[model samples]
Target: MSRVGKKPIALPGGVKLQIGEELQVEGPKGKLLVPIPKGITIENKNGTVEVTRESDKYAALHGLTRALASNAIVGVSSGWTRELDIVGIGYRCDVKGNLATFTLGYSHSIEFLLPQGVDMTVDKQTHIVLKSHDRQLVGQVAAKMRALRPPDPYKNKGVRYTGEVLRKKVGKSGAGGKGK
Candidate 1:
């Protein structure tokens, strides 16, 4: 038996879910849908959502489906949030409307056009907060932003996830010596 598949997910307030070929969740934030795979069944009763598989043959998929479905439900209710921090001297981020402009120690500033269903907030010029009802979309957008200025191993400077720990590498000392 899959432990995660057997666990019941509770729906929070203002959230409504419907189970069909796929699971549809709607709330104040937004709506999310999770496709139901073969040998999997979902039930919504008493404000709790449950997922079950026909047999152990789908143990892996069963747990994965449950996790995905639960995330969808929670996403519509409380929603999902991702944070990113830009590191570097003079590095700043400004968001207006759906476009975010970044100045990350580059010759030219970079602008990112946010797709639908994702919103962001910039704090203190370097900290960024992203919100969305779809977990996967939110994560993908954050990844793309991080890729723009990925963390450098030596300097450990660049965009990084909130509270992310990185291993810093020391630079070699300058020594000018000629061999005979």
Candidate 2:
């Protein structure tokens, strides 16, 4: 038995679940659908939801289905957030409506369009906050933003996640006098 699959997910207030070919989770924030794989079953008892697999052959999918369902419930109920910071002398970002303009030390500024489900806010032109009811969408948006100008190992400049630690690499100037 998969431990994660056997655990019951508590349905918070304002969240509703519809089980069929797929699981439809709706709440105050938004709605999400989790696909139900073969040999896996879900049941709602009282305010809790449980996932069970038909046999050990579906062990791997058991945990995955449970996690997806749990995330959907939580996402619709409370939402999700992903934060990023722009690090550099001139690196910054601005969000106007559904468009985001980024100055990531490139010759020309990069313009990114926010997806329908994701929302972004900029603070002091350096801090970026991404919010959405879909956890995967929020994470994907953040990753794409970070990829625009990944942090430099030597200068430590570019977009990075909040509280992310990076070990700065020593530049050529720090190398011993081999060129001298």
Candidate 3:
């Protein structure tokens, strides 16, 4: 038996869950759907939810179901946030409504259109805050934004996650060349 699968997820106030082919969790923040895989079953008892498997063959699915359900529950209840920072002398980020304009020392500024479920805010013109009701979407959006200009190993300049540690690579020195 999976330890995570055996644990019951406590339902918070104003949150409701529906179990079917997909688990639908509705709460104050928003609603999230967690697809239920085959050989796994979910039960809602009292104020908690539990995931179970039909047999040992479904051990993986059991844990997966529980994790997805838990994420959905938490997502709908409190939502998720991902923060990013732009590092450079002239790099900056600006958010106007659903559009975000990034000036990463590029010849032309990059304009990124945010998706429906994701909301972005910029602070200090270099910090980005991405919020979403779905944890997966939050991570995906952050990754896409980071991919725009990943941190350079040698310069450590680009978009990076908050608190992300980067190792700076040493630049080459011509003094190492043989006497000419």
Candidate 4:
């Protein structure tokens, strides 16, 4: 028995969910499509959604599907957000319309094209806020942006998520090598 799968997903006002071959979620934020895998059945109740598995092998997917559906519902209703912070000298970011320009101490700035329905905002050039109704898209965009300049373990300089902690490495003491 999956506790999460057994739980009903409460539907908030303004958000409409259609359960079928795929989950169609629409709300103020935007529209999102969540694929319904085989062997999983969705039951729409009074202002709630439920999931059931067609076989025991799909037991794991039962909860996963339900969780993803819940996330989609909430995302479309209130949206999702991911934040990134630029570290090190000259590390910064700028958003222009649907594109984001980044300068992670590199010689040239990098430009990232944003997909539709996603919004990005930069604060103080170091803090970036990404917003999207689709949870997957938001996560993917954030991951791509972070991958542009992953934080280095040595210097801990690069792009990282806000509130993300990094384990900084300690430099070796001055000791001449070459067998002394």
Candidate 5:
């Protein structure tokens, strides 16, 4: 038995769940659908939902289904958020409407368009906040932003997640190493 699958997910207020061929989770924030694989069953008892597998052959699906369902429920209810910080002398970002303009120390500024269902906000010209009801979408957007200007190991400049730790690499000692 999968421990994660056996656990019950508590349904928060203002959230509605429908169990069928697929699970539909709807709440104040948004709606999400979780696919149900064969040999796996989901049930709602009272206000909690439970996932069970018919046999050990479906062990992997059992846990996966449970996690997806949980994420959907939480997403629709309270939504998700991801934060990033631009680290450089001239690196900054600005969001106007659905478009984002980034100055990541390059010769020309990069313009990125925000996808539907994802919202972005900038603070202090360096901090970026991404929000969405879909957890996966929020994570994907954050990754794309970070990839635009990945942190440099030596100078530690570029985009990075807040509170993320990086070990700065030491530069060249001098030009007199092993010189006769």
Candidate 6:
């Protein structure tokens, strides 16, 4: 038995689930659909959900199915959040409705459009908080923002996740090498 699959998921109040070819979880916040793979079965018993596999051949699916279901349950119930920070002298962010404009020391500002089910908020012009019911979508949006201006290894100037660790590369030293 898979360790994760063996554990059951407790459905909170106001949260409903439908198990079929896919699992549909609906709650106060929103709804999430999680696909059920082959050889895996999910059952809702006593307000808790359990995942089981037909045989050892479905070992991987057992854990994966459980995890996805768990995420979906939490997502619909509460939601997920991703935080990012802008690091630089002139790098800042502004949000107007569903659009975010960034000034990352570039000649022209960059505009990012927020996708459906995703909401962004800016604080102190340097902190960004993204909220969404879909965990995967929140991560993807954060990744795209980071890719816009990845942190500079030398100066560490760009957009990065909060508490993200970066190693700064040392600059070239004065001419002190073995020279004739």
Predicted candidate 5 versus true structure: per-residue lDDT over 40-119, tens digit per residue: 99999999999998999999999999999999998999999999999999899999999999999889999999999999
> How do the predictions measure up, each by TM-score?
0.95, 0.96, 0.96, 0.94, 0.96, 0.95
Per-model clash counts, in order, read: 0, 0, 0, 0, 0, 0
CA RMSD of each candidate after superposition: 1.3, 1.5, 1.1, 1.4, 1.2, 1.4
> Per-residue lDDT of 108-141 in model 3, one digit per residue for the tens?
9999999989999899999999999899998999
Model 3 ranges with Cα > 4 A deviation:
174-176
lDDT of 6 by residue, 45-94 (tens): 99999999999999999999999999999999999999999999989999
* Candidate 6 residue spans exceeding 4 A from truth: 176-180
For model 1, where is the 10-residue window of minimal lDDT? 171-180
Candidate 4: stretches off by over 4 Å: 178-180
Kindly list the per-residue Cα lDDT of model 2 for residues 11-50, writing each as its tens digit.
Answer: 9999988999999999998889999999999999999999
Please provide, for model 1 over 1-180, each residue's C-alpha lDDT reduced to its tens digit, 9 standing for 90 to 100: 998999999988889887888888899988888899999999988988889999889899999999999888888878899999999999999999999999998899999999999999999999999999899999999999999999999998899999999999888777757667
Model 4 CA lDDT for position 89: 89
Evaluated at residue 175, the lDDT of candidate 4 is 75
**Where in model 2 is the C-alpha error above 4 Å?**
174-180
The TM-score measured for candidate 2 stands at: 0.96
Pull out the clashing pairs in model 1: none
Output the lDDT of residue 151, model 3. Answer: 99
User: Candidate 3 clashing pairs?
Assistant: none
For candidate 4, the lDDT comes to: 0.89
